[model samples]
Target chain A: MSRVVVDVVLKPEISDPQGQAVLGALGRLGHDSIRSVRQGKHFVLEVDGTPDEAELKQIAETLLANPVIEDVELHLTKD
Target chain B: MRIGVLTFPGSLDDVDAARAVRLAGGAPVPLWHGDHDLKDVDAVVLPGGFSYGDYLRAGAIAARSPLMQDVVTAARQGLPVLGICNGFQVLCEAGLLPGALTRNSHLHFRNRDQVLQVERADTAWTADYAAGQRIVIPVKNGEGRYVGSPADLDRLEGENRVVFRYVDGNPNGSSRDIAGVASENGRVVGLMPHPEHAVEDLTGPSTDGLGFFTSILKAVVNA
Candidate 1:
């Protein structure tokens, strides 16, 4: 089995409704100075079979990430 | 069947999310973000809302929630996982799906009923619709545009992974006018619109969103 690390990042300057809502709630509670906010996900996986970069790429495009709103990186993690 | 809807500290739509699941003829289980268990639900939904207050990023924080460990595991095991809006952000952040949600090109929050073309209907969450069907659903979000490198976008298009695309106008300036996507396994799906809010005619803008819920049900039953 091979271990892989995947990281996804959202594009910059997108309005984050969740973040804005938090800032709004915080401001209502008297906290301030929040300039900006964003969100993303990171994943580690262990898969069986011969490690193939092509298969990994397929995973990234199909299930691992949305090409439209996100960018993803897949790295081989030495076990 | 039981469907789990995860709720993080900042989640805004857990109740509505659970309601949608119930409306679709499944039991809705509220899974806590800090818990690492999925309650063995048949399917999972990462509902839209400000999880972790969108701190660090829209889904960056919630992606690391304790419950996500199980979500990732179940998804890898071929369980159906659907992420909507903020949930879509979490899926990308959790590395359960590809692509990323970015700020709208206009840098403004958009909320309206948007029309979308179903590009792929083979996923566990989208099997009920035809490939070329157009549906309307509620889409309210701050960071919703989908972006990727030109080459990467081409790969997605070439592979038929682009599941949903905007029909009338690009809502958030997503490249290729993409609206949603699914995993190659057809077990997982993620989208920018709020399908849960469109299940009923009286409450939802149109009944088009019901197909999403029904699609998953059919996929699960068939599997």
Candidate 2:
């Protein structure tokens, strides 16, 4: 099985309202970098078959991330 | 005509986009974001959704998808590609079209039926529309504001590339109330509104949005 890790991050200067909302909530909780946070999702996919790293990277580029709003990092691990 | 709708991992509207293409009398081809092949589709539609879960920016990461490389090549070769909402975000990230879509100044997720004026009927996806004709379509997004440098905006205006403009109100604070635009070749078009949802009369405020799909068919046939 092949496993892939995808990291998504927002662009600089683009205000993340969702992150701001969380920051506000966190401040109320007394957890303070918490000045603001940009919200993003991370995915770990385990493919059943052997797909080359190149093939997997293709999927990450086209399907997993949109370059305008998010940047993605792909890491492959063999178990 | 064969239409390809790219499905990114977080893409929300691939099914709806495929349905819109089929309803418009074209074959809908489901293309994976990872695959480099376009599957011999004549046209492509980048549907709305929070691709990559709107992770890095919105459409930023998805613009670099393996399939998008092929998309960029095909688009340059004259294949018509339409980007709606987040898809519009992807197109700009890919540099397939000019300008960028930013967050609304109001900083909220805005959703509503928006009226737009068809500003450029000469484009491939807008041939069925008449200049200045008002059409209603759904606009929904948080980072939906359209932005560009003043010089570029002037150039777009001078070059007549502005395809659509908000008619009644600017929902996302888009510059010059711009809602949609097309590439110089007219083969690549992107808009902040959701035209796919408005194609069916039963689900749509009006059937005017179907004209965008039909316009591409006609453009493909005539080309």
True contacts kept of each: 0.32, 0.11
Worst lDDT run of 10 residues, candidate 2 chain B, spans B54-63
* Per-residue lDDT over B36-130 for candidate 2, one digit per residue giving the tens place of the 0 to 100 score: 78999889999999998876567888888899989998889888999999999999988988888877867788999999999999888999999
**DockQ of candidate 1, scored on C-alphas against the true complex (2 decimals):** 0.16
Every candidate's lDDT = 0.81, 0.85
Q: How close is every model to the real structure, measured as TM-score? A: 0.75, 0.76
- Residue B145 shift from truth in candidate 1, angstroms: 0.7
The TM-score leader among the candidates is 2
TM accuracy, model 2: 0.76
Best by DockQ: 1
Q: Give the per-residue Cα lDDT of candidate 2 at B53.
A: 89
Question: Per-residue CA lDDT of candidate 1, range B1-223, in tens?
Answer: 8888888887777787788877888788888989877888889888889987777568977887778987888889898999999999998888777777777876678899999999887788887899898999999988888876677778878888999998888878887898888777878889999998998888989978877777777777888
Tens digit of lDDT per residue, candidate 2, span A1-79?
8787887665654456678777888999989747767887798989887757888777766566655445678877877
